[model samples]
Target: MQTRETFAGLSDWQVGLWYALVAVSVAIFVWGALRLVLKYRRGRGAFPTDNLFRRVARTAWIVLTHTWIRRRDGVAGLAHALIFYGFVVLFIGTAILAFQDDFAEPVLGWDFWRGPFYLGYSLFLDVFGAGLIVGLLIMATKRARNPARLDYGRVDGVGSRYERWRYTVGDWAFVGSLLFLGVTGFLLEALRIAETDPSFERWAPFGWIAGQGLQAIGVDGETAASAHFGGWWVHGVAALAFVAAIPFTKAVHMLAAPASVATRNDAARNRLVGLPPNPVPEEIGYGVVADLTPAHLLQLDACTKCGKCHVACPAAASGYPLSPRDLVLDLREQAEGTFGVRASLGVEPLFGSDANLLGNPIRPETVWSCMSCMACVEICPVGIEHVPI
Candidate 1:
């Protein structure tokens, strides 16, 4: 019988406004996702649909277990796994709350999100939330150390300073934003617990401890209540915005990378297809970005800017200005800028001629510098068909 109320203090108008914002956020997310699907469609061929169930199972196992990521850097992999699991727990926790609020209690009169269940859920999320922050700290520390593999130093140096700074900022921002969201979530919970001063909330161990600290620091019930109201909206809005931004940011990897794994073909990666028996000039291999297979196009988006491929490439090791990582990123920049959210936002592309890839950003030296050893493809955690691309 120890249940927390949803939307307890907010007026009807504020609740309505929140739902409206939620609607807007969902619409934007859907729009961006559709744009990505359409962008993939623009490529030459379809991703194979055979053995879908098996592929999906394989993908889920690989992705959820982080086996591929762990192969190279065990510490980074463990941190990433923490982040992934924490995010999943929190996400599922939110869904459970929403279900009870919207359907279980009101519609079905099955008010079960209380007592043991609520307490357990609270404790679970509190632990995972802390884990999320810990994971981010680990990653940020790794970034600070400036490891050779995580180096964002540009080999091409097209926009040189701007691109380097932007990559650096982008990586930091991704980590920072998730960290911010995680911290704010805990703070919001603490404020609520402080406002109530309820014994039941002790089940939420972290929130209870933080709330006691706040009370000790002269945050009375009234002050905590007022602060909670504002913090609720802040966290809610930011969370919604984060959801909407997923398809447009590095977060898109959450979707694209898994899909890349699911659709990956060993046959496609290993074998180089030869020309047709009576091949015309147009019937040969790729001449433009448009000629890439849909899977390859999708793979471009799956690149997390993780520099393992760059480190693995012999060309890079031999002092060539060709980073497989950078090459994928440059193409992704072109893809994003030419279509989808970046294009819609009027962001200019960073690579290749608008007509076709090769020169403007990705130099001929960059292309020829590739040793065709498939080291990048082998080293890539995500199923990016680098050699084929």
Candidate 2:
């Protein structure tokens, strides 16, 4: 490995490009985070905590223990954690790569940091990537069989084809992207070792497999090197694209989840309690009627559409007119639908005269069908707390 410090190891173009990417990612992350935090605090007026420490302790317990979601989602919960935590670990790995490219390599004069760091990293990648891959496979299989076995065909109230299709495509895209990223990373490592550094072969099992395959191809040293670099490009590009796509894709929840956890209300986990009273005389509703706030829209976007909520929804199982998944999906649709209306008709607040807590346009059965069991709330990985309408 080259003993080159930081971005100095990278050519000027590579360094500049990496810097730009990291800058954009950080900027977007910060903006979204600040907006969510501010909105949450503003929406829930500040007050002195009576059991500040205890409340925090309980929140920690709830999140770390995952007592609620685990109980409601069961295997689906475990699968979600595998994917969620795997991505978390993957993020750390990516950060390390960034530091190596941007800081460590330049500062430490070493491209490859051996010993404990590298070993631990390799182990993390193998385990977490395996977990993500396995979890996704289970999820995909479940999606395929869930509809048929759950008798969706007979259930007239099941979610629409468009919603199902969106979910399936989103899930597959995320899975495929992650898989390709991991696989190509290993391939790059293997090629690097076979061509330039055989020592890495001992610590990198995945890479060794790729290197062996390269040797089988009977390519010359130059060809192998080119192929290896090409693979690295593919891996890096996929990773970059995944990052860019986050705010615009279902994967956005990966980032929103922590914030959701921090701000989520346990009591409201399974209901849509009316929004706090709008003190304005002209105010029309309690919750969103039209022109939902950015934060509300964020929550809608954070939905993974995994149907864990649907599984727990009494309405879904009882042949009623409500499914929690469909509810959120409908809210999203309403928001989108109102986008045009908002500009012309002005925002219609959903409280006061306009308020219909019993589900108004959404249907009364849909509102009452919720058991308020908080099962849907408990099961949502993103901490979407739905309560009585």
Best-performing candidate as measured by TM-score: 1
lDDT of 1 by residue, 294-377 (tens): 888899988888898888889888888888888888777777766656777777753332457767447888888887888888
**Per-candidate local distance difference test:** 0.84, 0.59
Cα RMSD (angstroms) for every candidate in the order listed: 2.0, 5.6
Clashes of 2: 17
**lDDT by residue (tens digit), candidate 2, 1-389:** 42213222246797678668767766765554554444334322342245556656765676565564566457766776777677778788778877786687788887665566676677677678668767766666666675632222323343343235655667678777876776676666666656654554455566556677777777536776777656665676577777766654567676655445555555575345554565663243335433343444556656767666777767677787667776776665454334322222344422232333235336666776666777777667666655532
Global lDDT for candidate 2? 0.59
The candidate maximizing lDDT is 1
Candidate 2: Cα lDDT at 94? 72
